[model samples]
Target: METSATVAFVVYALLFGWRLVDAVEGSASVAVLAGGIVAGYLVADLVSGLAHWVGDRFFDETTPLVGQNFIAPFRRHHVAPREMVEHGLVELVGNTAILALPPMALAHHSLRPDSLPLLFSGGLLLSSLAGAVCTNLIHRWAHMPRPPGPARWLQGRGLILSPERHARHHRRPFDRAYCITTGWLNAPMDRLGVWKAVERWLGRAARQDPR
Candidate 1:
């Protein structure tokens, strides 16, 4: 089944249909529906963070429950626990707000119907999926080392991802690149992607002018 947020966002968008109700004929379901989406996505992320926080705080497991072996290859780059907490906190806040902003804006002037369930459910489903997909993509990129040459150009746009830009997060291990996903997710997003791109671009520059 589609996650609650994914289903919810789609349904919320379709809320334009609620106009059929005579009582809310002029209402814009966008706000109410989107708000539900925002809330749903935020809740999922909150849950995930809570899990991570609890795991880190209580389990005393140095390795994650999942991806222990996969991430092992990158052990040379294991970040400090303090860094994880700081970066993770920034991610928690930024990601939650991103989901919340769209619907919150729409709600200010929206006209929703008496039956808010459709929009509510739809919003939750769509938003939930958004967090999952976006996070997954970013995490994937962060794990991979920078690709060579023209692929270097990707670093410029790679902020949409997580792992690729994460190297700087590893190097500094204290400040910046807090979020692996988007610039909006954290200033570190822009910093990480841009720095990686420039690093690659400089490599290309040196190769072309090698004296």
Candidate 2:
């Protein structure tokens, strides 16, 4: 698992680098591409939050296959906030990269970098993958006793999830502040009651509490 995860991480990293280079080289408007990248990052933030919220609120860690691999980790995470930091890098990256790698590979093969729609979507997809792939590292930084200088700088600038911001998630019930990447979308998503609406709809549809 570790080996495969490392290989996947490396492959995706190279692809992302190539995508950026292609976008910059092929783009007629660097400013527009840059905006796309920013938009992509924001999309990632929202996706991460939505995933986190679902994992935290929806299922138990014993629901068949997903229970062990996916649901369990979130449960463990809420219990031991720094537990993932102790895990090997391969485990970290592999678990997070699964959802991201395939779409990225498809984008690389299918999208033309010069086309505006393709370029923006490609940028958004890759940036979202970056945010997702690095989620564990960013979350760990939020718990580190003494995070490295660069991490501290990034956290301070709100470029990554900071310790102060993440601490709120660890509090009782663990309901709010679900986004663990850049956390740029937490406020708006929560204010809009998006997760609540989803839960309510799912419960009504199924005639059982989904939360």
Candidate 3:
């Protein structure tokens, strides 16, 4: 896992450099790239919330790959929220790196300098990939009683998950505030009743007759 994470990091470092130089020399405007990055960050927030909700509610520790890799840890977290702080960097970032490798590779091969399509598509994917990779670190900070001064500052500014905001999820039933990266989408997602809607839909599907 550590090796895979290391390889993934190297790949991203190289790809970022390549894209940076290409965007500078190629036709894609900086404005377009910026838009793509913002969109990507938002998308990552939504994805993080969805994934967290599913892991928390839909499965158990006995379930297979997802069970062991995702659901089990979530279950453990409900009992010991601080466990995340003990997690090694490899555990925090490795699996995400594996998931990110493909999209980063695709962008590297398919995108070109100055192209709006490249900026919109490739930039969105790469930036969102970055956000996803940062999820664990942000979550750890949320759990800390007193993270570093800089981290506290960022959390206070709402640039990252704040301890007070994340505490709601740690409350009994563990249902809301699932987005841990930046915690930007939790309120909107909760207000829209998105996760409840998904649960009802899935419950209905599970009850359908197989015959």
Candidate 4:
């Protein structure tokens, strides 16, 4: 009944914490995962912009108007750029914690109890970092415009480990590929067609803008 604020805060806190964990995991590895996340954070605007532009450009007569309605309003109004940046990290932590559950459970239950704890713990942490990094990059990329603030410093590798790309997803939600750091897997993701549309548009734009 009275769970509104409590629920919201809890959700916010989890996102904030999780992103921190994601940032940490990303730091440990510097390849695709790390780069993706960093890309998400540093150039969220570009990534999301490309994603959105692609989505629009490739949209056919039946561009799945169903889901867009729910997402559009939320993107335009509810998602606060300030809160998401501050709280996004917490959500990342929560996500990693959730990811750790299977590994953690196995570690807790298995007889002889192998290195599940170490492996899964590492996995959980890394998952957060990877997700956050990817999420930030892919997210910021999708949103079109960058989030405002001195917090933009987060995009810089020196200060924040996570990517800024995540901002775009918040600002302009879409069904194509919602994740921040993992664009490669977008095709494998559930909405293969949508992701393809986004890619097609992006390809067209690249040919034209050459930016």
The better candidate by TM-score, 1 or 3, is 3
- Global Cα RMSD, each model: 14.4, 2.9, 4.4, 10.9
Task: For residues 1-211, write the lDDT of model 3, one tens digit per residue.
Answer: 6657647765775777467556654344667777777888888888888788877777577877777987787778887889889887677877777777777776677666456766676668777888887788889989888888998999999988899888878876567788988888899888897877877878843221111
State the weakest 10-residue window (summed lDDT) of model 3: 202-211
What is the model-wide C-alpha lDDT for candidate 1? 0.42
- Per-residue lDDT, model 4, residue 200, is 67
Clashing pairs in 3: 26-114, 27-113, 27-114, 28-114
For residue 28, give model 1's deviation from the true position in Å. Answer: 1.5
Q: Is candidate 1 or candidate 4 better by TM-score?
A: 1
* Candidate 3 Cα deviation (angstroms), residue 110: 2.7
Residues 143-193, model 2: lDDT tens digits: 888888999999999999998888867876456788988877777877897
Per-residue lDDT tens digits for candidate 1, residues 1-211, read 2244444444544453333233332346666666776676565544433333222222222447533532322232243323332243234234444454456335423644456675565566545545543453344444545533333454456524334445544464333343443323345334455434544665643221100
Q: Give the total clashing residue pairs for model 3.
A: 4
How high is each candidate's TM-score?
0.36, 0.86, 0.86, 0.29
Model 4: ten consecutive residues of lowest lDDT: 111-120
Over 98-122, each residue of candidate 4 has an lDDT whose tens digit, in order, gives: 4334433342344221233333343
Q: How high a TM-score does candidate 4 get?
A: 0.29
The TM-score measured for candidate 2 stands at 0.86
lDDT (Cα) of model 3:
0.76
Q: What is the lDDT, from 0 to 100, of the residue 40 in candidate 3? A: 87
